[model samples]
Target: MPILEVTKITKQFGGLTANHNISMHVDEGSITAVIGPNGAGKTTFFNMITGVYQPTSGDIKLNGESLLKLKPDEVAKKGVSRTFQNIRLFGEMSVIENVLIGMHTHLKTNLFGIFLNLPATKKEEIEAEKEAYRLLKYFGLESLLNEKACNLSYGAQRKLEIARALATKPKLILLDEPAAGMNPKETKELTEIIKRMGEEFNVSILLIEHDMKLVMEISEHIIVLDHGEKIAEGNPKAIRTNPKVIEAYLGSAAIH
Candidate 1:
């Protein structure tokens, strides 16, 4: 069975329909790219799936179980995690601390236990720190663990956001514009890292990226959306030649 499934999901904001009967599936341990022009509802669809907004109609499933009614935190607890298009990090916090915060969902410490310095709380905190360091090391950010988040370069900041998301130990991760601010070299590195995440960590990924070269290089499957609807779904080779996809990009004067 697919790891993630969206079945005829729709979302409306006021009278404007942001997503329209969208359906897709992401296989286990694969990278799936969602591409579209601006105002095509790609981000809106992502928001709905991740619980930033509830679907006005239809359902989403992870591992064949319904995720439609769950709140954002509940959805996250179910092993779904995501990084935003804009980097969202505590600027003043150390890189390691920012990652440790992501592990909060997995920590079992209560307020009383934390205040009393209970053994369980201490153990959990230690484990969280270890896990955060491991993630930073994986992303080549171990050397910057003590640096403030805002002090890192733009590319490093993006990687830090991804590291924080991975700290959650999610079975599936959704990345919105992971290569948005990256230079050519940085984008190339990100492509390799994404591939490694699937191959080594055994995690499935769903990404929305405007970088066609990066998407074509990394994605195992690709879905194209236009104006709140799916226009095409296939592998990179097929998507590139898809008339609908070409038309969608060219019509809107949006280059891939």
Candidate 2:
């Protein structure tokens, strides 16, 4: 069964319908990409899935359980995590500190236990730090752990945001335009990291990215949306050549 399933979901804001009967699925341990033009409602679809916005009509299921009623934090606790199109980091906090905050949902300590710094709570805290450090290391941000988030370079900040999301230990990670601002080298690095994440972490990746190179390179399956409607779904080779896909977003230059 697919790890994340969005079934006939639609959203409207007053008079405008943002998404219309959009349905797609991300299988376990796979890399999937949702691509489209600027106003194609890709982000809106993601918002519905991550609980940033509840679907106006239809159900979203994670592992077969309905997530329509869950709040954003509740969705995170259910093993769904995401990074925004715009980097949302604690600018004043250290890199590791930001990642540690993501672990708040998984922390077992109660208010009383935390206030007293109980031995058990302390032990869990230590482990959480180790896990955060490991994630930083994986992203090659270990050396900057103590550095303030705002002090890091743009690319590093992007990686840090992803690290924070990974700290949540999610079964599925939604990346909104992860390569939105990066040089060719940084985009290349991100492609490898995203592929490794799915293979090594056993986490499913669902991303909305306009970087055709990264999307084509890493996505195992592709979903193309146009004006809030799904236009195509297939592997990269097929999507690259589908006439509708070409006309909607990826122009003739996309294939060559």
Candidate 3:
């Protein structure tokens, strides 16, 4: 069975339908790319899957269980985590601390226990720190662990955001525009990291990327969306040759 299944999912903002009866399956341990031009409802579809918005119709399932009715936190607890198109990090906090915050859902300490630094809380805190460092090291950010998040370069910041998402211990990760604002070198590095995340970490990935090079290089399967609907779904080679995809990129000089 597929790790995630989106069945006829639709979302409307007033009279504007952002997603229309979109259905797809994300396989286990694979990188699935959702590609499209701006305003193709890629982010909107991502929001629905991550529970930032509920679907107007249809169902989403993870391992055959419904996720349509779950709240965002509940969804995360069910082993789903996502990184935003825009980097969201605590700028003033140390990089390691920022990652540990992502572990809040798994932490057992309550307000009272945290205030007193109870032994149990201390132990959990230590464990969280260890896990955070491991993730940072995995992403080549171990050297920046003690530095403020804002002090890192743009590419490092992006890596930090991904590290935070991974800190949540998700089985499936949704990456929204992971290559946005990146230079060619950074984008290339990100492509490798994404592949490693699936292979080494054993997590499934669903990516929304505008960088066609990155998408084509990394994704095992590609799904193209245009104006709130799926226009193409296939392997990288097929998507590259798709006429609809060519049309979508026609006026977008940057895409070519």
How many steric clashes between backbone atoms does each model show?
0, 0, 0
Q: Tens digits of per-residue lDDT for model 1 on 1-256?
A: 5999899998888999988999999998889999998889999988887888889999999999898878999999998999999999999999999998998888888899989999888998888888888889888999999999999999999999999998888989999999998999999988889989976666899999999888988898999999899989999889887889889888533433
Which candidate leads the pack in lDDT? 2
> Model 2, range 213-242, lDDT digits (tens) per residue?
889899989999999999999999999989
Per-residue accuracy of model 3 over 70-167 as CA lDDT, tens digit each: 89999999999999999999999999999998988777889999999899989988888899999999989999999999999999999999999988
- Each model's TM-score, in the order given? 0.95, 0.97, 0.95
Model 2, residue 38: distance off in Å is 0.5
Instruction: Report the error of model 2 at residue 111, Å.
Output: 2.7
Query: In candidate 1, which residue ranges exceed 4 Å CA deviation?
Result: 251-256
Please estimate how well model 3 matches the true structure, expressed as its whole-model Cα lDDT: 0.91
Q: Return the candidate ranking by lDDT, descending.
A: 2, 3, 1
